[model samples]
Target chain A: MSGCRDWLAHLVLGLGAALFLLPIWLAFCAATLDPAAIDRGELSLVPRLDHLGVFLEVLRHGGPGVGPVWRMLAVSAAMALAIALGKIAISILSAYAVVFFRFPFRRTAFWIIFVTLMLPVEVRIIPTYAVMADLHFIDTFQGLTVPLIASATATLLFRQTFVAIPDELLEAARMDGAGPLRFLWDVVLPVSAANLAALFVILFVYGWNQYLWPLLAATSPRLDTVVIGIVKMIGIDTSTEWNKVMATAVLALVPPVLVVVGLQRWFVKGLTEGEK
Target chain B: MERRTIFPGWRLPLLLVAPQLLLTLVFFYWPAAEGLWQSLTRTDAFGIHTRFVGLANFAALFADPRYRSSVAITLVFCAAVTALSLGSGLVLALAADRELRGRDLYRVLLIWPYAVAPAIAAVLWLLLLNPQIGTIGRWLVALGVHWDYALNGTQALLLVIVASAWKQVSYNFLFVLAGLQSIPRAVIEAARMDGAKGFHRFRTIQLPLLAPTLFFLVIVDLVYAAFDTFGVIQAMTQGGPGRATETLVFKVYQDGVVNLDLGSSAAQSVVLMGGVILLTALQFRFLGRRVAS
Candidate 1:
């Protein structure tokens, strides 16, 4: 900013970046190493390249007390995507209804949904688990996704977006005898596409990073998400393959990080704008 | 907040809202009500022979030294995490806000950590902090420091705190940077014209403007530290080394899931739900005033 500030800024930022990357770099290096090498703990800076196959090895066969990495990856993907889309769909609908249509108990219904902000599945996991068990949805995709899909954040965001849409456009749509569904499909959705896209990235990451819900809901080994499996693998009392554990951790983080980086612009926009 | 143009059909709105309402009722309100109810009742080991124990579970929780310890650790954890993450985040944001070379590259590098799941972040730190074969752990040992989180409760707590804060710094950075950038260029120019350059201008002008953002970040980080760090504690320490790292969130899980102490867990959940409601209310109050003015 000032004459002497440039170098200082760069230094500070560079140090921060290095601090953040150091762990991941170590993980990456170890992931490519033989178990014996990792056991030695030299943690060579130079790539060993001897066990590049560890990634596939870990993917094909998981460590103790865990399933195949690919299936865990798929479960993570499914949970993340389902939560994202389900939240977007339900929130958009509810937001549209609350913002655009006046009903008898509209305010009551809105508060009912809004109060959900207070209780995450974490805070109420015991009861939520009981519900899941009662419905026989435990270990099911619906259990992992449905309870998580009702999003106060997205609903609030969509409501703000929908409310910001000029009255003129909706009136114009109505003048053409367009019904509510048609108006939502053609006008509201198209207008809110940016918000929706931004929200998708945010929600996808939120869903992908879920730890406790999947841990509780999916007890079946086949259903264990990577986040859960990583802990289970490391949590076991037996000997842990540090290399594979690091490899699996790498697999666990890569997708969500890619989503954030690939959609960087929208992610920031959604965070700041959605907060407002 | 009324929309001027409206869809006039009541039936359609009802149908549209039904799915969300149903899901909310099924997953949210019902369980929340149940959590509340469970907090009031005590069940035997088998969940049968249930009896109403109004406020007994809560009283017992407060009476229990372990619960108090959990709350104390959570408070301490929240304090350390909020300070560490927010402070580093502010510095990072300030540095990255400059028009230096490759600032965008730095920003991208810093922000991607937000995608790291909390447990994975813990695992990352575990790899670096584990005394056996860890990088920094070896360094610490070489420096004559006894670096073992497994056997030492304080070290375990510190490890979880650092790892938790590390995961959160990226989030705070984004918000802080946005807050910094949102300070109008014209205002900064005006301050600079008055010889309020560098740290003087920032401390006098920019910091006050960024107060609201800082406050919001503090609360956000507090809630994150309290609730969202279950994964980190679970993965890293499992609340071990004599229950040192056991925060309220983890205790809720441990007691409820591992120990099957449903009443205690439910009571704790209710308390946590109260915390969330209070935090949300604080946020909305400040936010509402901000919007109003």
Candidate 2:
């Protein structure tokens, strides 16, 4: 009976996995097929491995109204890295400041960052766009990344991690004659390294997956992240390059998927713990 | 909770926090204030003139039939997406929680969908459900089903909901699975000894204990369906087939960005801001003690 139950569990889990993996598998195969065949509604379950050059073809020159895949991927990578690393850097300092030092108005500073969490970019789109325009930051990399780096999530997570560090650690550092900066560099950072990695994966995915912000902020095709580029590729139905769209779609998901999968343990840990 | 041991001088700490403070003030607070101001004021068709009209935009928004429908659409969308995603996530989490072989591999496969961008998820669904080029879509057509989301309003809404929920299930699954694992083993064993088995045991024993996690997920999922699924809706339906899928967030974008209706959009933005704040406050209010413990 237990064996039967195990079999039932496997079957159920397998179906759930396939529900996700099948669409992607079909997309992979569709990406490799000739564009003419796909247009004719002749999608195959099997990929034509020899036609895998479509990935490179799309990478070099994208479909109508879309920039090169390589550039979008680069922009996305840069945005994700900048948002992740920049957020980590600032959040670490700020969290460290709030946790370690007894500064005046420190709670005020923390509350200010916390309040920003309620105002997602979606709610304040127009005014934020206006602000971006006023700064002349529109259609620029700074426009794409910098404003997004001020993350309350990272700050809060780091604060949580820092607060849990025993008071003895701080005393030991003080006893060793190390300054705050040195203690942070040596003790604080090393202790929070795992968290940093986890937050990196989460924020990296967040930055890479941003669509609405980049859609309104960056008008130039050069500033298009992969997510925005794919949307544009499919926007025009007149002479839609189905194969290229599929290839670009695949390209878009690969980096973030790889990051999440490679750091699966930390990503899961951070996601559940940080959010709740 | 205040810390006991601390670094003394305030200057270093203030310096450390200044960058985040500056960015938060300029980007977050300023934009929020601008949205508030814009909501209360109107701009002429020409870009030149602007005047404060005091609640006029809000009054007009409430009076507009389209805005009311958008609100209804948003509520329904949030509800459906939350239910579908959370339901499937629970089932998957439950199935994976058993000591079955290769459970770890099942988890990795199940959770990777979290990484798929909402826009990319839309594109993938299009590849499956596009009437002409889609594999299953073509099959559905051959089976005499009217399967075009592009032209059909109901179909379009369904597609966006599924696509939005698809991208979110992994998040819910991670949380639900964690919640399941966190339940004490002794309790489950006691339930088993009480002769409760399989579906009966889950319904009575596991389900009740999972309430807090479920409550937390509902709020998160509602917020996600409200805001984050913009990419999904924009890519999939563009909230079209005659405004069938246009939730409140999409309406704000369409009015503000495409039509350049700044006042109405700002009003909608303020409304959304209120909704988010309420949702967030409720989450913390209900879940604060749970989180603390």
Candidate 3:
């Protein structure tokens, strides 16, 4: 009876995992096939190699309203870079201060950042949009990237990483006539390289996948990221050409997918280290 | 004796914190404060004209039947998604916890769903389940089971819930797997020596230690459901089939963006924020203390 139960459990989990992976596999098949083939449902399970031209067409011809699909790629890449750099720089510095210093309201500030995890963009969209509008930041790069730079998660992770560093390292640097900034650059950051790489990949993925904030803040066509572009292409009428939509979807997913594949090690490391 | 400085005092902290502080104050805090102010007023989409109605918007929202339904739906969605993801994630973590063949492949495949954007996930599912051309719909028809999310509100709600839960299981699984691996194998060996086999070992030795990871995951998943999946709903159903899937965030987006009723949307935002804050505090008070130990 126990053996039978264990087998049943294994079957249940294996099937669930297969279902979890199905949609992503279907998406790849859909993206690769010819539109006619897709409509006819000819290649339902397996993709035909000959129809790979559709992806190339999407890359070359571009989708409706948006220019060449490559333009969207450039936009997403630039935005992701800006968000990653901004988040990391600010998080490292803020984490340094929060970890090392004794200040008035220090605990309060730490808790404030921590609590912001519970207070998400959905809860504060109205005011954030208002600020963006007030600053004339709407439809600009700053509007798209600035708000996301203040990530509580990154700060929390960095603080935990910094706190784990031995105090003697900082003390030794200080005795050697290293200023705090110099010490941070010379000693602290090098020791934290592994954590930094992990955080970088995580932050980059976060920026890459951002949707709502960019949708609200970016009003101009020139500033649209791949996600907003794919969503806009879907159209409220649902009359969008599925071919182009899938093509755009493929485009939007590539960078982050590549990042995940390339930085799989860093991603896992970040997850494990962040939990610690 | 002079207090010798180990590092430069004040300057480093100020510099390190300045950028994040400026951005947070301008973006997060300022908007949060403004949202509070906006909730009590009457305003247009563009904010060109505004009048102070003093809680009238909140009163109207509270009086609306849809708002009441939204609150209930939000709670149900949060609960269902949290339970499903956590439950499935734990099972998968346990299955992969052993020295199985192809374990690495299984782990990779399980986590691949998380790589896709939620918007794309919604779109992919919609295509797979569209009443007319959807693969799943055809399969259901083959099996003599009627399935149409567009006409059936329950079907639509269930689909969204399932999609949200599936998207997050991998993420929860990653953490749970890590937590499982971190358990000292010595403890499990000792349990086995005492004849704590299989379920007994898991329930008595494993589950208790895994509680902290599960607690963190539950809170994180709740927040994601509340905030993140708005894009998915917007993409797939648009809260359709008579507003069955119109979650709190979806309604907030609709009011603010589609309907262009800024004040009411702000009021909805405030209510949602308040609920989340209260729930988080309660979670910390109840579960967080136990997990911390």
Model 3 segments beyond 4 Å from truth?
A1-17, A40-43, A103-115, A236-238, B1-6, B44-49, B282-292
Selected candidate, larger lDDT, 1 vs 2: 2
| Predicted complexes: DockQ each | 0.82, 0.84, 0.50
Which structure among the candidates has the greatest DockQ? Answer: 2
What would the per-residue lDDT of candidate 1 be over residues A2-115, giving only the tens digit for each residue? 657888888889899999988998898888887777676778666568777888988999888887999999999998999999999999999999999999899999999888
Could you give the DockQ of candidate 3?
0.50
Q: How does each model score on TM-score?
A: 0.98, 0.98, 0.92
Per-residue accuracy of model 1 over B1-293 as CA lDDT, tens digit each: 79777978799899989999999899988898999999999888777799999999999999999999988999999999999999999999988886777877998999999999999999999888888788889899999998888899999999999999999999999998999999999998899889997788879998999998998999889988988899999899989889999999899999999999898899999999999999999988887777677
Q: Where does candidate 1 stray beyond 4 Å? A: none
Task: Report residue A46 deviation for candidate 2 (angstroms).
Answer: 0.7
Candidate structures ordered by DockQ, highest first: 2, 1, 3
Candidate 2 residue A27 C-alpha distance from true site, Å = 0.9
lDDT of 3: 0.78
Candidate 2 per-residue lDDT, tens place, B132-157, comes to 98878899999999888878988888
